[model samples]
Each structure stands twice: as C-alpha cells, then as structure tokens.
Target: MKIAIIGTRGIPNYYGGFEQFAEFFSVYLVEKGHEVYVYNSHNHAYQEKTFHGVRIIHQNDPEHKLGTFGQFIYDFNCIRDSRKRNFDIILQLGYTSNSIWFFLLPKKPISITNMDGLEWKRSKYSAPVRQFLKFAERLAAISSDYLVADSLGIQKSLKKRYGKDSTYIAYGAHPFDNPDISVLDKYELQPENYNMIMARFEPENNLDMVLEGVVKSGDETPILVIGKHETKYGAYLKGKFGQYKHIRFTGGIYNLAELDSLRYYSTLYFHGHSVGGTNPSLLEAMSSQALICAHNNDFNRGILGDNAYYFSNPAEVATLLLTTKKSDNLQLVKNNFEAIKRDFNWEKINGEYLQLFEDCMARHQSGK
Candidate 1:
C-alpha cells in the first residue's frame, strides 16, 4: 500500500510526540515492505532522499518557522502535493487548520488523523487561539474518514467536545537493547541515585510544581530534568534552578543511546503532566522498568493501571518520595514492564495501525 504521513514538522523527530510517532511508523512500514512517504519541512535541513527505504518529500517554505502561520503554510503545501501523488491513504497526525485542502485532493484519499491531546485547554494558548483550535478539531473530526485517539481519555474528550467517536490506538515505544555505560558518567548519577523527569518544559507539563515540590520535600535524592531548553519556560527553569546542587538540568540529550541509558538507570521517573493522553515519555519510562510516580489523571491511571503510584498535590508527591521503598516498588515496576511488553511494543502497534489503514481503505471503497 502507498501511504503518506502529513501534519508534522518532519523526520529525524527533533521535536515532540507526533514527530517521533511519524518517524517510527514510517521506518517500520517501509521495513514491512510497504511504500511510505513523509512530508518534510524545508527548515528541517533534511535532504530530499530516501531514509531507511522511505521517501521524503521536501515542502520548501521560507516562512515555515513562523509558528501557527508556518504550520498553516506547510499543511497547505503538503495537501497540494499530496493530491498529485495519488497516495492510497493519507495519515494526518494532528488537526491542521488548513485541512480544507484535503477536501480538494483528487484521489480523495482515506484520511486518518490522530487527535493529539486537547490543544485548546493548554495554558500557553490565548483565548482566541484556543477557540480556533476547538473549531479546527471539530472540522478535522467531521471531515476525516477515521479519527484516532492515543488514549481512551482523549477519545472521551473528542466525543464530549465534537460529538465524534474516535478509534483508540495508543502510541508505541521502541525497546532499548544494551545501553552504553560511559554515558552515566556525564550526569555523575549512579543507576539508582537520582530521580528523573523527561518532558518538554512547558506550562502544561507542570515542571515548576515538580521543582517546588522537590525543594519543599527536601528528599535527599538528587533530581535530573532532561528536555529541550529552547522555550521561554525552559530558560526560566534553568535560571531559577541552575544553582541548586541537588538538581541537574541536562538540556536535551538527543542521542537515543544516551536517553535510553538515562531511562534504564534512573531509580524513579517523575511525570507531572496534568494534561495530554497517555504521554509517550511516561509509557517509555514504564517500559524501561523505572518506578513511575505519575500525575493523578485518568489518562495516566488507564495506562499504568494499579501497578504505578499517583500523586496530586505536592504534599502527596513529597510523601511518596520519602516513604516509598525501592524493594516494595520493584514488583510494580516489573509488572509495568510486563504490561508494556505485552501491549505497547512497536511491533504490535505497527500491525494494529496497518489493520486500521486497510479497514479505512476498504470502507472508503465500499462507499461507507
């Protein structure tokens, strides 16, 4: 089957969840003997060439760095090009406001979109932008042939907000094999000495709350926060927390080996995201067999089940940090690892995606 993935910043995934999803799915589909193409942004510095046997279509746009406007332009150009490609299916990872272009495509490809976390509820967006996002999400749901939600919580949100029934297909995490031991020396963190938090330094991620909680708790365990230090929030976090001897802010380690090493060695994983549906980082940390103490939310609970710890207020988190025993948490961590292996592995997820694609194509052909 010929497939095209759209609505992301492009490959090599230097950014967030959807980009990484696209990268892994594209490569996996290619490996499975399917022809796959991805839309790459001109600003990404990616060559117009095949990567891992998957074709990359470079959409050149100079204004592609201008936030929402750039995304609009990129999506419009990608849709224009997609019409000419005659793809069997087009998978959009997010709701692009310019998605009206999909309606103009010649093939009228079976469109499948992953309705990522509730963008409208994010604290960073202005009132107008949030209102616009709500409308765009409705349009995408009504227009697309299939809508996918990464978690049941997101599916519920879609139904409540837009009156749309979405398919629940969660994101997958790749398993890490042997990690390099030398990378541990960089953080001066032994295998189980420090608590780790890996996520974007955004307002929704609640990094400040976590930091303040740690400071208030005064748990002797050191904390290491890893993420891209590009945003204003990230900069502020560095400015405020940089001097602390117990807290180490390692700005964005991109190498997979280094990331995996951190994940595998960390004693505990701190997840403070109050929004979003089944965060990729949380799932990955669980897969790595780290004891996960996630934000108290239905999404996190659904994924971790009863095998993980949850905390709402800083006091609860602080209490957990001080009271939980490594020996007692070991079984829960092992259970989470077992669950991930059984349910969230990339191989299983890729097969599920292919089946969904085929079903969408069949339904489209049958005039359903």
Candidate 2:
C-alpha cells in the first residue's frame, strides 16, 4: 500500500509524540513492504529525500514567521501536494491545524485521522481558541473516513460527544532493561538517586501544581524537572520553584536514550498531564521501569492500571512524596514495565494500525 502521513512536524522527532509515532511507524511500515511517505517541515534538520527506506517530503512551514497560522499553511501545501501522489491512504496524525481545510482534501485516497486528546479542554488556549478547537474536533470527526483514538478514554468521549465510532489504538514503547548509568554524569545525578518529571511546560499539564507539591513535601530528595523552560509559564515555574535548593530544572532534553535513562534511574516519575490520551512520555516512563506518580484521571489510570500512585492537586502530591519512598515502588515498577511490554509494544500497535488501514481502504472502495 502507498501511504502518505501528514499532520506532524515530521520524523527524526525533535518534537513531540506525533512526530515520534511518524518516525517509528513509517519505518516499520516500509520494512513490511508498504510504500510510506512522511511529510516533514521544510525547516527540519534532516534534509534527505528518504529516511530509513521511507520517503520524506519537505512541506513549507512558516511557523517561525507566522506562528500558529504557519501550521495551517503548511498543512494546506501538504494536502495540495499529496492529492497528486496517488497514495492508497492518507493517515493524518492530528486535526487542529488542518480540519478547516477538510473540504479541500482529495476525495480519492481513504482519509484516516488519529483523534488526539481533548484539545478544547486544555487551559493554555483562550476561551475563543478552545471553542475553535472544539469545532475543529467536530470537523475532523465528520470529515475523516475513520477515527483512531489512542486511548479508551478518548474513544468513549468521541462516541458520547461526536457520536462517532472510532477504533481504539494506543501509542507504544520499547523498554531498555539496562541502559548505561554513566549518562547521568553530566547532570550530576546517580541511578535511583532522584525523582523526576518529564512534560511540556503547558498549563494543562499541571507542572506548577506538581512542583509546589514537591516543595511542600519538605523531603530533601533531589527532584529533577526535565523539559523545555522557555515558555512564559515555564519561567514562572522556574522562578517559583528555584528557591528550593534540592529542586533542579534541566531544560528539555530531546535525546530519548538520555531521557529514558533518567526516568529509569529515578526514585519516582511524576506524570501531571491532565489532558490527552495515552501520553508518549508516560509510556516511556513506564517502559523505563519508573515507579509512577500520576495525576488522577481516566487517561493516566487507563495507562498505568493499578500499578501507579495518583495525585490530583499539590496537597495530594505532597502527601505522596512525603509518605512513599523508592523501596515502596519496587513491585509497582516491575508491573508497569510488564504492562508496556504486554499491551503497548510497538509490534502490536503497528500491526493493529496496518490491519485498520487495510480495513478502512477496503471499506472506502466498497462504500461501506
């Protein structure tokens, strides 16, 4: 099958989850004898025409000059060019930027979209923007031939709100049992010596709440907050939390190996994401065998099952930090890694996507 993947910054993934998925899934699809093409941002560093047997097409992205609006232009150009490619399927990773142009999309290829998270509910966006995101979600749901929800929580919401039936598929991770502990030398950290948090500095992600909770705990255990700190909110957090001597902030590190190793060696991993279905970083943390401390929500509970400790606010977070120690999470860590291997493995996830694509294509042709 000839497949064109859209709606991400593209592969080699210096960005977030969608790009990471594109990187892994596109390569795997090519290896399985499918012709896969990934649309990359024109400014992305990897300029080659092909990467790992998968075709790469650079689409213009003026995000630097135009900000969020540039993403719309990039998607427009990508869809326009893709219409002429004669691809069997169009797999769109997200719809926030492109759903408005759904009418302009080609009618020939089967369109399957991955409906990611509740964008409208995120606190980062203003009220009007949130309404626009809600509309976009509806447009994408109506426009696409099929919907892929990354978590059962998302799947259920799609059914209740949009009255759309979606296939429940999850993001996957590969575990590294024994990564090099020497990677911690540069950060002045040691294996199982620190607790950590990995996430973007967004309001909805609840970084402030977690950090405050940690400070209140009064446990002098080293807490490493790993993520980019350039945003306004990020600066606020650094200013707010920097007074605590044991709280260290490392601006985002994109190297998965390094990040995963950090998580693996952490005394505890805190996941504060309040929105989204099946977060990539959370799974990576689980895969790395970190004893999980997660926000109490359907999405996190769905992923961690019964193996994680949940927190809703700073108070809960502080209570957990003061009460629980690394030794208490040994069994929980083992259970989480097992969950990743058994259910969220990339082999199973990619296979499920392949079958779903084939089914969508068949149904599109048959008018089912």
RMSD of each: 2.0, 1.2
Whole-model alpha-carbon lDDT for candidate 2: 0.90
- Candidate 2, residues 1-368, lDDT tens digits: the string is 99999999988887888998899899989999999999999999999999999999999999989999999999999999998999989999999999998998888888999999999999999999999999999999999989999999999999999899999999999976877788889888877778899889998888898888987888888888888899899899988888887888888888778888888788878999999999999999989888889999999999887899999899999998888877876988888888888899999999999999988878877888
Q: Give one clash count per candidate, in the order shown.
A: 0, 1
Candidate 1 local Cα displacement, residue 254, angstroms: 1.3
lDDT of 1 by residue, 1-368 (tens): 89999888788787778888888899989988889999988778677578788899988654645756777877888888998898988899888455556576555677888988887888888899888888887788888878999999999988887788888988887666576767889878777778888888888887877777777788868888888877899989888877777887887878876877787777778888878776888878877777888888888898988987888777877787787755677889788888778888888888889889888878878888
Q: In lDDT terms, which candidate is top?
A: 2
Error of 1 at 135 (Å): 1.2
Clashing pairs in model 1, backbone N/Cα/C closer than 3 A: none
